[model samples]
Target: MNRCLSGLVGILFVSISLVSCQTDEEIKRQRYITEGILIFKNNCANCHQDKGQGVASLYPPIAGSDYLRDKKSVICLIRYGQQGKIVVNGKVYNRPMPAQPQLSDLEVAELITYMYNEWGGETKLTNVKDVTPILNACKK
Candidate 1:
């Protein structure tokens, strides 16, 4: 009976330890994705829709978009807004996407992380450390 109890305890401890072993980077990535969802709902949902399917002939879809091929341009446009006509998946959208200058570099990083993970076929975080320099350079 004693040996059985000890073995059970050891197994439980190992299980708990394994469950708690998630890397810090993964934790931060999850947090960024959570915040990004809220940001999108508040700032982008009206035109882009909740699932990023876009509004007919006006806004462009973000999910499965060919436009996402230009990561740099996507990042720049998020902060500086977009003008003129743009094509997405062979459809032309002429509406202006107002700039979200209020979003901090961190917020942009979080947003991109969420977007890429959810739709851009990415499985990694887009760290704020990487986003700041890009944002700084795009400031006009």
Candidate 2:
């Protein structure tokens, strides 16, 4: 009976250890994603839609978008906005995307992380350390 109890405790310990084994980066990524979801819902979902499927021909879809291929441009546009016509998945959208001047560098990074993970077929985090320089360079 004592041996069985010890075995059960050992199994419980291993299970807990495994659950707690996520790296610090993984934890940060999850936090960024959560914040990003809130930001997207509050700021972007109106045009981009909740699932990023976009709104008909008026807005362009972010999911599986060819525009994502130019990540640097995407980052710049998110903060500075876009004017004139743009093409996504062979569809041309002429509407201008307003700039999100209120979003900080960290917030932009989080938003990108969420967008890429959820729709851009990415499984990694977009760290703010990497975003700040790009944002600084894009300042007009």
Candidate 3:
């Protein structure tokens, strides 16, 4: 009975340790994704729609957009805003995209991660370390 109890305790301890053993990157990724969902819903959903399907010819569709190939441009558009005409998957969208000045660098990172994961077929996190400098360099 003693040996059985000890074995069970050891198993439980191992399970607890394993569950708590997430790396920093993993934790950051989870946090970014969580915040990103909210940001998208609040700021982006009206134009882009909840599923990233934009309105007919007025807004550009985010899901399956060929423009997503230009990660830097997408990042810039999100931060600094977009104007003039742009083409997505052969569709032309001339409406201006308002900048999200309320989003910080970290929030931008989270937003990018969420966008890429949801629409761009990416699984890795877009760390804020990568987003800050890009935002700083925005010409728009």
Candidate 4:
């Protein structure tokens, strides 16, 4: 009986540990996504719309954007913006996208996390630690 009880306790401990880890990840993802939504709304919604649908030919839709294929470029673009012409889901947009120098690396990570999850079909959190170096190396 003691051996059986010990085995059950071990199983319970393992289960709890797995659950704790999963919950921790979920929490981080939720926090990043939440902050990202706010950042997008305040900074990008004017051109991209609340749903990321963008406006006509002048602005590009972020929802289901093919440009998200290049995650690094997306991150850099957020920090330094874009200029000239770029194709989004086959549409051409040439307007200058103003850079947001005010956003910290962490804020950019949160925004990236949210945009990917919401529109790019990503399930992982883009941690600030992972984003800092990228931002530092941005050529734009």
Candidate 5:
């Protein structure tokens, strides 16, 4: 009887643990979205607009930007801002967006995750580990 009770308790414990873990991804996704939205509003909303639609040829749209579609390039550019000119979404945006080195890797990841999931782009759930290498590889 004791053996059966112990087994039942262990199984119950494992079931509870698994159930708690089930929502971790969703929680992380929500947290990333929240963090990204805050960062964007604070730093990017002025130029990118609240909806990520660029400011009429001044700033380029971030929602469906080609730069974002190329994940590697976008990650690199974010880690190290590009100068000169670049074309995004069939339009040429000439302004230089300064690199956000002050932001932590986790913050940057959350920002990227939010951007990818938000607006009209593909929903990619980015994490700190996912983007850390990109930052490390950047020459700055």
Candidate 6:
């Protein structure tokens, strides 16, 4: 009976350990989303709206935007805010988006991740490594 109980306890421990161990993909996805939400709420929600739909033609709608779906362009825009006229969903938004250079690459990646996942996009995860180059390239 003692041996049986010990075996059962060991199995329970293993199960708990496995449950606690999140895969890299899962961890990345969670990190990406959580960071993204915080950054978005703080930096973007005012102009882009809480849902990323933007406020009329004043700002561009980020939610369900074809522009956001293009990872390269999106990264560029995030790293260095676009100047002059830009169009989203056939609407022209001429306002300049101020550069958020204060944020780290990791934070920017997280913000992008949150925007992609929350706003009718696919499950592709954006990591710091992927974002760093784009951020560096933006300066040149």
The candidate that achieves the highest TM-score relative to the unseen native structure? 2
RMSD of each: 2.0, 1.5, 2.3, 4.6, 6.2, 3.4
Candidate 2 regions off by >4 Å? 1-8
Question: For all candidates, what are the clash counts?
Answer: 0, 0, 0, 0, 0, 0
Worst 10 residues of 4 by lDDT: 17-26
**Alpha-carbon TM-score of each model against the true structure:** 0.90, 0.93, 0.86, 0.83, 0.78, 0.82
Residue lDDT tens for model 6, 34-101: 87898998998889988898888798899988777578778777767889988788878898998777
Name the better of 3 and 5 by TM-score.
3
Task: Extract clashing residue pairs from model 2.
Answer: none
Span of ten consecutive residues with least summed lDDT in model 2: 63-72
Could you tell me the lDDT of residue 129 within candidate 4? 93
lDDT (C-alpha) at residue 1 in model 6: 62
Task: Give the candidate number with the greatest lDDT.
Answer: 2
The residue pairs found clashing in candidate 3 are none
Ranking of candidates on TM-score, top first: 2, 1, 3, 4, 6, 5
Between prediction 4 and prediction 6, which has the larger lDDT?
A: 4
Q: If candidate 5 were superposed on the true structure by all CA atoms, what would the RMSD be?
A: 6.2
Clashing pairs in 4: none
Model 2 C-alpha RMSD to native: 1.5
Worst 10 residues of 5 by lDDT: 118-127
The regions of model 3 sitting more than 4 angstroms off are 1-18
The per-residue C-alpha lDDT of model 4 at residue 112 equals 96
The CA lDDT at 109 in model 6 is: 86
